[model samples]
Target chain A: MQQTRSIEMGTGLFVLLGMAALFFLTTQTTGSNSLSGSDTFEVTARFDNVGSLKNRAPVRMSGVTIGRVTSVRFDPDTLVAEVKLEIESQYDRIPEDSDAGILTSGLLGSQYIGLQAGGSDLSLQEGSEIEFTQSAIVIENLISKYLFKQDSGSDEK
Target chain B: MLRELYFSFVDFLRTFGALQLFFLRLLANSPAILVRRFGLVVQQVYNAGALSLVIIMICGFFVGGVLGLQGYANLAKFNAEDSVGTFAAFSLLKELGPVITALLFSGRAGTALASEIGLMKATEQLSAMEMMAVDPLRRILVPRFLGGVISMPLLTAIFSVIGLFGAHLVAVDLLGVDPGAFWQQMRSSLEIGDVWEGIIKSMVFGVVASLLAVWEGYNAIPTAEGVGRATTRTVVITAIAVLILDFMITAIAI
Candidate 1:
């Protein structure tokens, strides 16, 4: 009977501990991006090339994540990508004229949108598009361009 | 020869069809299975899950450490050593945790469950209980079945948790991989959907393993050799079932 009681107690601990581990993992992974309890507002940005920008990518302002990229769609007429961002309710003070730029974490890390605050008294409105946007800087393109320039210059010489 | 092959195929299908009905019967009678069974179920949980903790943890830790080491070696070649955490975590959470835990379970708990019930049948305990107006299916089988099924996912989760720590210990402490990058990449890459897939796989494997073990034991011939064969079949069949189920779930989920 004593052994059975202990076993039952151990099983309870096993379940509780598993729940704790799961809680820790989910919180750690989602961080502030959980979208639970926090209201979010949407804003769109247009870019020449969004390049590998995925849904749920973080949107940062001054190194702090204020939102996440919700969708990426190609604009057939403009020949650009329309990236929609969902900003947290707390970050409603972002200026109307601020620019959004796609940036890598390190040299080769995954891309995120970084918001550069502009000088304006009016705050950005939901559903309005941020006109000024910079696309992903493709390292391959830069490297190939440099190599092509080097080859042509040598040929001329 | 062709007629013999056709008969054998039909025999296999018949056995499979009966097993399917047995599984459905167990699941369909959930209400009767639940009443007065919680305590027994809990005891089964202790027997099956709590007892299995040590093996799961030890295996999880070593598997994690190996993943960390191998991932580091491979990622270092591309000057991308920081991504080791992401690699190890993803590997464990997505595949290793469920499949390996289920396989180990089929060996340890699966064999134990089969033998216990098979021996009971061999001794006419189930028949005696049936003669006493007690339903052995509800009283005996349900609790043990529930125990095995409930224990599996918890065991898998424990394996994953220990494995992550093992990976961290190897990648960050011993190998000198940047702790921030290791954790950061892991935090960023692992999503709810990926974890959900692992859990679902373990649950399905649990159902497959437990049901097969119980069914084999219940149907075993009433003799020492027959009980032994049933016990052996439990492990072998559970292992195959787990692997096949894992493949199906992965294909559908992916």
Candidate 2:
């Protein structure tokens, strides 16, 4: 009887632990910790290239995410990729003349737009375009450029 | 040839009727059994759940690690190694975790349920209960049935969590994927609906497998040879049923 009781208690504890673990997995893996609405203002930035920047990529300021890329498109007139960013409403202090650079976290990690605050008195508004933008750095392009330069120098030598 | 076809059809129908009769009786006895034999049911749960934990957790952790390692290798080819967590989570939560856990449960517990009950029948213990004016289905089958049915989903959920942790160890600690990126991508990619689907599938598999095990045991011939055959049949039939149900559930889910 005591053995049965102990096993019964163990079973209950086991189940509770399983439930807790499952809840942890569901929340952690799904990453939807936000309770507040996804309320944000949309803005645009143009770059010479987006370099495989997927839609729904993060927009960050000083490594903290402030927005997300809603869409990516090509403007034929400018011959550049235009990306629409949806910035959180709370981050309304970004200056109008601020720069948005397509940056990566670490080498080979996902590409994101890193925003730098500028010294302008005017802040960006909904649908505002940040003219100063940088494109994603393509490692293949850099590697090929270095290889070509090295070959040419060797031929001269 | 026509005679043989007719005989085979008859045999199939006979088996089907027997199965339906067993299921109906089990259902009829279920509510009464739960109320009257609550402690027995609890003891059955302890036997099944507590005993099964070690195997389930071990499988979850190793399977998760393998998934993480393999996912990293494939994602690394595209330099998208950070997405390993999302891949592992989807693979485990949506399909592998529940299905594998059910299969394992059938192999471990289903065989045991069959043999335990079958041996009792062979030894006339169940018949003796019938002589004493007790329904063996209420006395014996119900508690074990409830034990297996209840254990299934909890085991599957545990398997998934442990597997994810194992993947984390391999992906973040060993293969050098960014821990934040791995988790962030996984969280953003998954939703409540996916987890719910997994839970529902595992629960269904659990009930079906448990029923098959108990029914096979209850109907076994009163002999040692019959008991052995029922145990084997319990595992084989439960496994096939689980796979078929999984496919049907996936089709409807997607």
TM-score, per-candidate, Cα-based: 0.93, 0.73
Question: Model 1: per-residue lDDT, tens digit, B1-254?
Answer: 99999999999999999999988888876466667568888888887888888899999999999999999999999999999999998899879999999988888788888888888999999999999999888888888888888888888888888999999999999999999988888877777788888888889988898899889988888899998999899988888888888888889988
Residue-level lDDT of model 2, residues B1-254, one tens digit each, is 99999999999899879988887887788788788788887777777776789999999999999999999999899888888999999999989998999989988888899899999999999989999998888889988998888888888999999999999999999988999988887876687678888989988988888899998898889798999999999988888888999999999999
* Alpha-carbon lDDT, every model: 0.87, 0.87
Looking at model 2, give its docking quality level.
Answer: acceptable
- Candidate closest to the true structure, highest DockQ: 1
When summed lDDT is taken over every stretch of 10 residues in candidate 2 chain B, the lowest stretch is: B41-50
- Evaluate chain B of model 2: give its TM-score: 0.96
* DockQ of candidate 2 compared with the true complex: 0.46
